[model samples]
Target: MTGLRVSVGDVVDFGAASGDRNPLHLDREFALRSAYGRPVAHGALATIVALGLAADREELARVVELSVDFDQPVLPGLTYRVRRSPRGVEVRLGELRVLTARWTLADRAADTAPAAPAARGAGADRPGPPPLPDGGGPRVLGLAELAGLVDESYAYRVDSAALAELLSRGAAAGVPDALTGPLAWASFHTGMRTPGRDGLLVGIRLRLTGARERPAEVWSCRAEPPLVHRRTGMVTVHAELDGAASATLTLVSLLRRQVAAPTLVETLGTLPRSNALAGRTVAVIGGGRGLGAALSCSLAGQGARVLAVSSTPATALTREASAERLPIEPLTCDARDPEALTTAFSGVALDGLVLAAAPRILSLPVAAATVPECVDHVADAARLVLAPLAAAHELLAERAFVVFVSSSAVLEPPAAWPHYAAAKAAIEGLAGHLARHRPGLRVVVARPPRMWTEMTNGPAGAAGATPVGVVAGAVVRHLLSGPAASGRPDVLGPDALSGP
Candidate 1:
């Protein structure tokens, strides 16, 4: 099959159709703050697209059993393709398999005979909160009410013209297509009826019994008691559909861990009042969000005039700094553009420079990563680091210091983050080279552990992550104490923050 790209419009349309309006797949700001760093396509939408590309209309209509395993989130703007495997079909982004599916087709022909539509119900469009494992009973929803939650017409448009035609034909035939209403309902069942708001669906198993001759008007869905695993925070729910069509499905989902936004007050309170950096002027690249924001506050609190340079405007940071009367100025500049960086710092003389800008962290295994994927990540990091350093050279004081924000992942690489680890490792090497080449300059490399930031806000991403404020405090304190005596770009590990 040709390479297919899922666009933001596609994701939004699917959400309208599937009633899976989880902010992770719809809201850009919400997604940016979540672990994904951007909006993602729904797993069900991906599954349907894969199925449509893999099989013809007849095969899809005769599907008796289907199972899909979501290996990774299907993000928009990336080209994906469907490959027919020995067992079924796999949806891949570059070399990485995002979803895998297998299905069993019934040998017998589908029953096309029209039958009486089931009685329709007037249940609430938006149902109450889903039941937990320890409390509440099952939720019984009517087909009309469930369908009303999201646009069912848009569900038919899963990017395949043939699939959409088949769905329309099935609707006209008075049959509830297994791949349309029922498929969308499965998403609604997990996202709304079982795990509610925080659910991240990981896998699905669906079994279709005898085909319905006609669509059931008042079809009812009942979710069995939920099974929540405390250790893994995984919730498994079994839902059974009855009325005109009979089917059973199992959905496995994980609850996302919420990471609270760091406050300027909390961060400033963590550091002691010291004038070690007094009268010094520090320029912090990527100082608008995450660790950069915390560092800007910490540095300003310690009596340094800080230039918070970022690609985007840091309105909130600027407002907070103003209210607190801190010597922090927010400057918008793309660090990748040397001219822009130079222009942003034209008149300022820097006593110190902190390279803290980086791309969003994503999990892509080495085998699945293409050369361009790795190169792009490494290139982005190098540009963010090198451009600022070059721009600051003409503005540096006689004894200026430079701090390169590397990562612990470089020392102990993650299997799923070869690109990220490689980029950090390359920059760390550059820092060491710069330290050795410039004998008089003080260069420090900080390898901080996973911290609570939008970049690491997913369930697994936020797990055991250190607070950004805590790490910022340590980094500020280190700046005051000076670099190690060894002198070849004094590298600070995770232990540097573990004060005595």
Candidate 2:
């Protein structure tokens, strides 16, 4: 990383390039009334500066984790020094720290490597604006459309014009400048315009310089030619309004696409319930709420004696069980505590096992996370999967089924989710290993995408999340169907529940 002198003109240009219409950087009136008292460079601009400095040295095409804090404002016409940090980089204004950031490097391939394709973050480090409905605005950028414009770059202005219609429409629809859908495209397309192998935005961390907000009516956005490296590339963009930097973005781009190996789950349509599970004993860990609750009900309905395991039994689960006239026994246990789990499942001959417990997610950036903290997080989740397998794997009825409710996040690592994803990935691996080694046991892994559960009711959870019943049904379907002859454990992807 290197120190660089920045000008007010640089600030304005950044706003235009990143299409961050926030008035705090471009509108003097807005800044005067706000806490800053004057226009301040976007805090993300410092992040861009740090990223650009990193690109000069390391091949950071796929950043695993990024953390940035805006301690002070970086005003226009000031010089800032960017220096290396234990994690990533930091920006300073003389003695005051303007912004500090740390980044965890993704394992780069020896050759041109693809970025992590499944690297979607849960609103932790994504570029602003948020995803919004189309709302009859100008066409949004799509992958197919980006392919056609291989060498071309499109510029967007903030005024009420065809090029910037999306912004204007978003503003009219009460969309915040940072959360405007078009603005998201503006930041992402910067990578598409850069000439090189495509990459995804695996991670980002941005902080506002001041309380200033709003965007200038007139704006400019442009993507610089990507700085291509042997294994990675960096795409820089600057957005400006009225000759001031509103936002600057530097994207980590890899040279190839990432593809994961296929799991055991078949993508066939939903299979009907049968008496296959009748007169059998089953247990559902973390079955008090969300998909776990749903699975408990479904298993009970299928005539399995359901043991709904949770820290405490929820009223909803009890009510559902009673209403459905299904037999469900609530078992209290903390999976993280081995003694508690042992007591809860002692002497239980499980015919089917559903392990779906998880720990409280800190969701901290990798930079701030300690090794012990990460280990503990993974261990907590592991207990849910391992505890049941350990307790009942040998004692289960012949031809019994064991299902670990995994997450699809393992396929596409989400930002700030390394702990959770790692645990799920490990579970999947363990399930596969058990299936291959233990011929008599039916091990099934369910990699459900974001489900409409209480834990995932946020912005990311609101869209594309399958119903809880769908997740539970898919799990039971695989259990009833017996072990696949493919010599691999079934991995139920989200699509497994797409049908009736």
Candidate 3:
């Protein structure tokens, strides 16, 4: 398998075919704020592609059981490869494994029973129920309603030739034409009908029971009541399809965890108002969201004219700044592009500079990390500061302060985040070098503990994390009123928050 990439157009087509229009897969802005950090291809889409690749070696008609475990998200625009595994096949984005699959072949021939027609309702063509509430509660649905959920686009009018044509051009190839319809229906039933929006598919087990020579004109699917485990947030849905072919599917999914945004009022109220940073102008890179936004707000509260530079437009922050009469100007620019950074800060002379931009953290083991992944992290980290630093060189006031927002993980590296730890460590070294070479500059490296932000909103990521405002307040105080510059980088740890 080679030359396989999931484009935005492919995602749209998949959404129409499967009726799964989850924002995580379709909406760029929504996905930018989500845990994955960008639009990711559907897990079912990945699974089907893997199966199609496997069909090259094995016969699909002889396969009795197929199981797939989704390990990591399959991001769009990346080429993936399929390799034979001890189980069956594994999909890889470079050396990192994204999905694992196992296939079981039947000893005898497949059953040749006449497939039963599915039960239909008068309102079968109507839209199904809405997604679960945002507040997080149980949604009750009768089993019949779940069974009768119909996909208007591709369920009744499945085109095996079209599916085969689509799969043949990508990394997915060699899928038997007869198996395309059943495989697609399995994806549609799991993604759109049963668990719906909140579901994060963990694994899927598909069993082919009967064989059909041609694709069905009208395929009907029936699903049983989903078995949900409240404590583990796991849901299992069993579904049976009857058409030209008959198959049974068992889908295991986990409900996605969501963290509530902290109240801005409460966060601001915790800090005392002071004019210590009065008349100072500070440029905060990546100030549109996460800790950068919190730092911008805190700095503005302390009477500094803050330039909130971010890749995306900071609409909400801009509105808040205006309503509060705060001197926080939002500037949109990509930190990777030096020209853009220079243009965004054309006339601004900064009294202080904060390097707070960072890429979305991924939990990839060092052994599994590819060359591109490592280089990308290091490059991103370097660009975030290097570009802004170069652009602000002539614009800096005499003896201006510079702050680098390093992470505590640099010292106590997480086993799963070697790339992140290495990148942070590299920048900290750069900060030290700058302090040594530029004697007049006040350099500070602030290593804060994990803070509650969009980057760390996942359950495991949020554990033991400090509030973003608290950390931002401490950073602001240290920058303005802490000890004078020591000529070397002043490395501040979590203990710095205990100071006056």
Question: In candidate 3, what residue range of length 10 has the lowest lDDT sum?
Answer: 129-138
- By TM-score, how accurate is candidate 1? 0.76
By TM-score rank, best first, the candidates go 3, 1, 2
194-223: candidate 2 lDDT, tens digit per residue? 322133233333221211133333334444
Write out the backbone clash pairs for model 3: none
The C-alpha stretches of model 1 lying farther than 4 A from their native spots are 1-9, 19-23, 26-30, 77-88, 92-97, 104-109, 112-176, 188-198, 214-244, 264-271, 315-325, 367-369, 484-487, 498-500
lDDT of each: 0.70, 0.54, 0.70
Candidate 1 lDDT over 1-500, as tens digits, reads: 64445668777765654556667788887676666767888777777766766766655666778898988888776667789875678977666778988988777547662233333235523323223233333233332223334211111111222224333332322223554555666666565555656677888888877556755433466666667765566777777766445778888877665545455665655577556678999999988878888888888888899999987788867877887788889999898988898888988888989999998777666543245666787899899999998899878876678889999998899777888998999899889887887756788899998787878766566567777877887888877786543458888898875332
The sequence of per-residue lDDT tens digits that candidate 3 reaches over residues 1-500 is 44345777767666555445666678788777767677778877777677766665245556677888988877776666778665577887656677888888766545552222233345544333222223222233333343444432223444443344455556465554335555666555455545555456778888877767554645666667677665555678777776766778888876554544332452454467666778999999988777788788888888899999988898878877887777899898898888988898888888988999988876555543245766787889988989888998888887888989999998899866788898999899889987887768899998988776777755244556687777777787777666777779988897664223
User: What ranges in model 2 sit over 4 Å off?
Assistant: 1-275, 368-370, 482-487
Compute each candidate's TM-score over C-alphas.
0.76, 0.47, 0.78
Q: Which pairs, if any, clash in model 1?
A: 118-217, 174-215
